[model samples]
Target: MKLNSIISERWSPVAFSKKVPDDDTIQLLFRAASRAPSSFNAQPWKFIYGIKDVDTMYGYLFDLINDSNQKWVKTAPMLALGIVETVPPGRTSLNRFAWYDTGMSVGNLLAQATDMGLYVHQMGGYDHEKARKVLNLSNVHEPAAMIAIGYKGDPDQLPREIAERENKRQGRKSVSEFVTKNPF
Candidate 1:
């Protein structure tokens, strides 16, 4: 079976080139993300981005990342935090679909980035509490993931152990393992 090239070629990489995406490309990436469907169109996804070496926001985001991810993520020309508003606007109840919708938004972002010859590495390793404090996020806004964005770069630039892991083909389980017509 054949998959779309954009889906097949997309991957998370530890190495990223020094090139920085210009303003238009940055806007387009988020525009694609904004297009993602959401329950009741709450559109709770919000992104905070920082261009490396261009602003203090980058340093603030970098400081939130754990040491393990910082080693390689630092090379990326841009960084971003994916945030979700847990409660739908003007409602006190939790929006159960908030996280799921946020993931779809990021999925749109990944596809758009891949089609544009850029790459994105979504990371869950971050200081969640610190992110809230540093970004001055409101109680409703929750940081979901930190993202590294840039062109794919030389794996040799990564740590020896990580470099060895970088090129390995990641495998997915067969349909039989997870899919079934019967209700669980």
Candidate 2:
């Protein structure tokens, strides 16, 4: 069976080129993400991004990453922090689906990036509190994940262990494994 090109083409890579995406391209990515649907149109997703050489923001985001991710993520041309506003605007109650909605936004961003010949790798291995502190964020905003974005690079240039993994073909579980008829 065939799948959508954007869906099939998207893959997270530990190796990334040092060439930064242009401002227009980055804006396009954010535009796509902004179009994602949200509960009650809350649009709780937020992104903090930085391009290498544009400012010191990249280093600030990089510092929040764990040592392991830092090993390969340094070469990425752009970095972003995904966050969710747990509290809806002008409301006190928590939005239980905030994180889920944020993930959908990221999905939109990733699809747009893939269509544009860019690659994105989202990592959960980061210091969440550090990111919050670095960004000077309030409690209402919760860090979701860190994203490394750039063109794909030579996996051979990666560290031995990472290179080994990058060289292997990726596999996913069959739909049958996760789908069910009706029973919970």
Candidate 3:
């Protein structure tokens, strides 16, 4: 699909089908992320997926997500925790752009999912420490956020409070609001 079309259609999907996504689908999602560009090719982003019932420890990370997310998240058959490792490959130092790299990878993942008739909701209201234990992750892989994926489901499945918020039209700041022609 065209980049503009993809961007226009991409929204944080709050409801997802109960059916779990297939392995091939998951592979493609990560593959898209793998292609994201990074500073010095450091390739600092890493993803740990907890597929279906296979994630016996899912509850650890699952519980960390905000209560607001719990309603719809329970219906999603797949939850992905996207993380970023320490900046740079050789040095134990920080690179300010590592988070940017990870964010781009997530954008790739979301677009790929959308291309496959799937939906993704990126959320930051989660507990990173709990995710670390559930996924058995090391410090090198820090939890950046969680993404719930699947096909879109009935809007009725959401609570009235949530449903109301979901139905509201979303708005964005015009390019004029943030774009500037002059140097600071």
Candidate 4:
């Protein structure tokens, strides 16, 4: 897909078909993530996908979700937890760049999903501490975020609150408000 098309056409999808991603498809998504840029190549990301135990994953997230998000996420088939090691590097502080790098991977993954005709919804409205316990996750690979992926579906079937959001056209902040000509 062209850069502009991908940027403009892609949107987070909350309504997913019940179809779960096969191992090969999930691996392809991970492979796309692997190509994402990382700080100094420390490459701190480690991902965990929930397929067979999707219920557990959903329960885990359902418990952790920021109340605002739970209403919509009730239906996705696959959930990917983004993790990153935060140990300090030589003479430097903790790997602050881990999440940043992982976020890049998420961008790549989402874009790839878009290319593959799948849909993804990236979320931060989740409880990190509980996520650690349910997934047997550790602070080592800090659970930065979770993403839901699956086939797109009719938004009307979603919970009313999220269904409203799904119908609205997504937009970005004005470049004029965010871009700069030089160092601030």
Q: Which of the numbered candidates is closest to the native, going by highest lDDT?
A: 1
Better model by TM-score: candidate 1 vs candidate 3: 1
Could you tell me which residue pairs clash in candidate 3? none
Compute the lDDT for candidate 3: 0.80
By lDDT, the better pick of 1 and 2 is 1
User: Which regions in candidate 3 have their CA more than 4 angstroms from the true location?
Assistant: 1-3, 133-136
Q: Model 2: residues >4 Å from true position, as ranges?
A: none
Between prediction 1 and prediction 3, the one with superior lDDT is 1
Work out the TM-score per prediction: 0.96, 0.96, 0.89, 0.85
The digit string of per-residue lDDT tens for model 1 on 81-138 reads: 9999999778999999999999999999999999999999999999999999999999
Q: For each candidate, what is the lDDT?
A: 0.94, 0.92, 0.80, 0.77
lDDT of 2 at 174: 98
| Candidate 4, superposed: residue stretches over 4 Å from native | 1-3, 52-55, 88-93
Each candidate structure's count of clashing pairs:
0, 0, 0, 0
Worst 10 residues of 4 by lDDT: 51-60
Alpha-carbon RMSD to native, per candidate: 1.0, 1.1, 2.2, 2.7
What's the true lDDT of residue 26 in model 2?
Answer: 96
Q: Given candidate 4, what's the lDDT at residue 75?
A: 75
> For model 4, how many clashes?
0
Per-residue alpha-carbon lDDT of model 3 for 1-184, expressed as tens digits? 4557677887876666677788898899999999999888877898766766768545655777888788778777788888888656567778778888999999899889888888888788887777777678766677897988888877778887776655665799998888999886
Segments in model 1 whose C-alpha atoms lie over 4 Å from true places = none
